[model samples]
Target chain A: MTRARLGLGLLGLTAAALAAGCQDVGGTVALGVRDEAVYAREVHAVLEARCGTLDCHGDARRPLRIYAETGLRLRDELRGQPLTAEELGDNLRAIEAIDPGAAAEDHLLVRKPLAVAAGGQRHLGGELWATRTAAAPTCLVAFLGGRDDAAMADACAAARAEVSLPPP
Target chain B: MSRRTLAQVATLALAALLAAGCLGETPEEQAARALGPDTCGGGRRRGEDDDEGGPEHRCGQPCLFCHSASYNPGEKIFIMAGTVFTRPGDTVGVGGAEVALEDAAGHQVSVLTNSTGNFMLSRGSSLQQRGKGQVRVPFDLVYPVSVVVRKDGVERKMRSHIQREASCAVCHAAALSATSAGHVVLEGP
Candidate 1:
């Protein structure tokens, strides 16, 4: 009986440790997904289509401009460059125009086209991401955690939990 | 060494372990502490308001992302400091011009200029400089900041689309030429 109790205690300790390891309370988790790669695959095209306009990000006069001539070329260029190289630096800066630390707060993901109820802000250029839930995946919601922090954090937490498990 | 005794001990140990792992300051509280005081960027503390029934003087912690001189891959801090003037080409400061910055999230705060026309949108606390012209204040730089100045029934808004530049004097400098207006001026007298 004493031995069985000790074994159970050990199992509980392991579970507690695993739980603590999985929680990304302070954004400590690695999130397993590289935001830059995700930006390349899911985000870059949308930004080019919506924001890279004649007077907006594509324009040099504007503080926030996306100068890429073509979406296909832009993706190829940004993704191909080594991290240290200064290629597509301005585009990256536009992506992080708002808080880079919190995706939900990033202006690129939520500002313009998105409605007030969906956490979008007013932009002189006009709205980009219009709805939170549409027939197809609104690229903005997928990137900005689908509406708020709880959803985004859950995704991060899930990624971390999966990564924490020992490989079979 | 009964089965009941083993089960009770295991249950108590598990509960204790769970309690130890789960109890502590919330994430928001930890973010507040990590960023520093709630002066310009976080939630307002109890009794932070003045006796005259003024607005709470707290700001969000995210301002460090842009305004902080010291930054890393992790976090930052800022000194909510700026200046206000009578108008373009005027040397004298505009006392009592209400200077306010509204973020995209709709969080806003305002402060009055001193006799020098300098307004560091802070509470009574003096700003501590981190770099040249940089001070510590509760400012989150994530949302776009809109700088507005209202005085003598006249208001002036920034022509630039976004308030990315926190240091007002950097762009709205003292005039060096005829075409260049050294200071930010109110549209009306």
Candidate 2:
């Protein structure tokens, strides 16, 4: 019951937690869940730029449909309008519909459109990222996998930087 | 003339002017014109080669208005239709251009603009254009489509996806500022 023993025990617990929290960045899939704040900020832009083109997931008929400012909007309106909060909610619901209350990485939401070498299946969208090591899919996977905030931000930022909406 | 006669004559003249104005512009046309009134210049007059009659009619106008017009407005629900113009102020349509479209389902369809720079894809659409005349099309368009206008090896790809607005003119109206990004301009030679 000494102060030294208590301090040592706390340190040991902290170390174990940190290691457990580390994302398994290789082939191994992480246990996943959707994050609203991260999705609204970072993840949605990645999807909009890569997958949300009209000939792709931007279509409402598609199961994992996406809406973007530079891609598709849910309704007919001005072009320069930014993505609305309601539209973001609609997109989140579309992702939620894939496998309600389940991990996203285990589902097609994360698998399809991913590189074959990156453990993704060839879907209608084909391969978005050539490998899982790429920033976009990595960011998406890490966010879906419920990785730490710092990890998610880094991955997402890197992914966002590489993509931009094509000029109209 | 007496004061009463003069007043009566003035009233009749004012009434004729208002009536003529109403007869000239329909409600929808007025609404459409109001959307972007200045792009085509004030008190615009039709040019000699302006879009009129057949599929080539109504250039720089909200095309889908034909869908609900009282007369023989349109045969089918034209899902995708627009006029490609060389400049914002240019009323003449850019003909011989290729309009490429791809839907969410990975289906791609391409059509060429006739002399009037008009192209359309409708649901169960049978009417089409061959050269400067009308023909039939076997294909149908799926909604939420993306478009690209190509001419002279130049590609003007649309930056956003269309989510069920049948006419590009709905967003790109007579007034360039009022419309989405102006009327699908393909500037330069």
Candidate 3:
């Protein structure tokens, strides 16, 4: 074979590879599978801001404590690393509670405040966040759905307008 | 991606495959999902509808784990219960002490300790000041509330947020030393 023919064949292979590797705006390379890295960056902070109030998940006794230390444990888990036995159990239970395919509809998000308008009952914690899509409830919805941060921020900001922080 | 030359792209595919394998769901996560905890003290316990199981089933603290502590179905839990003593090491319960919970909405729910130094928060009694004879709009499901304990007209306020810490003994345990006996105790006159 000639040098030109070999170069032409290589170019064809590269083209096919590029087409297969095309990705969406977010960093996801494929459909399905939850992205823990995005969750750690965008959704985790939102949880800390909204859920980590005094007398709530901040306490050790609550079912889902959202203390800063817990965030560390979550970060480790997101990286696909090992968790302490205690952290593993807690995280697994939490993961089980969530529906990765339908994160917004998860009991965790739906049971929060602002869910009433979204066809969900009023949260005793008073609606931490909301969205037009019930199955895709909060700003974390966008992040969970593989949307960019800009989209998540916009969604959460809208939900925040309707949200009233419980009295101090 | 534009910065990648032909040589880089060829190598990139192989790197991506290797990285994906390393960062994918781990065996520990799978084990945790499958086997769960081996002991009662393993991890957080799921709330039980009826109080029949041992510590493993009821180990969740703050009382919400086993009881529907909230007025709203959204909270899906119940109020707190614990015995308060006159002093850290005393065996005697402090009766007639005023236990009030102030929520973020400025609503106050107060109850007196029974003879056993036990008190339970009631939805009927909450929203006393601003509820206007209606179910309080914002319920105290998992939000933060300030717990104020008063006796002899003197008040002791807990400024930290205590979401579902229904069982005070979870933090306040009996010990012989200052550091060891970390229990919530009211001062004696």
Give the number of the best model, judged by lDDT.
Answer: 2
List, residue by residue over A71-156, the lDDT tens digit for candidate 3: 22333233213224454344334533444344544444444545566655665556644555532255655655557667677666
Order candidates by TM-score, high to low. Answer: 2, 3, 1
lDDT of 2 by residue, B1-189 (tens): 999999999999999999998789776565644533222322255453442346666666665666432422344445567788776667767888888888766777778886777776654445455554233455655555677888998888776666556677765654433123557778731
lDDT of 3 by residue, B52-146 (tens): 43222322123332334322222323355545556755543566777777766676666666554555443443343221111222355345556
lDDT of 2 by residue, A83-115 (tens): 788788878778777655556466566778687
True contacts kept of each: 0.00, 0.16, 0.15
CA shift of B5, model 3, Å:
93
Question: Could you tell me the TM-score of candidate 1?
Answer: 0.32
Residue-level lDDT of model 1, residues A80-159, one tens digit each, is 12222132454655555544555554444465556666676777654433565531124444554533344444443443
Comparing candidate 2 with candidate 3, which one achieves the higher TM-score? 2
Q: How many residue pairs clash in each candidate?
A: 23, 2, 21
Superior candidate under DockQ, 1 versus 3 = 3
Q: In candidate 2, which residue pairs clash?
A: B36-B175, B128-B135
What global local distance difference test value does model 2 have? 0.66
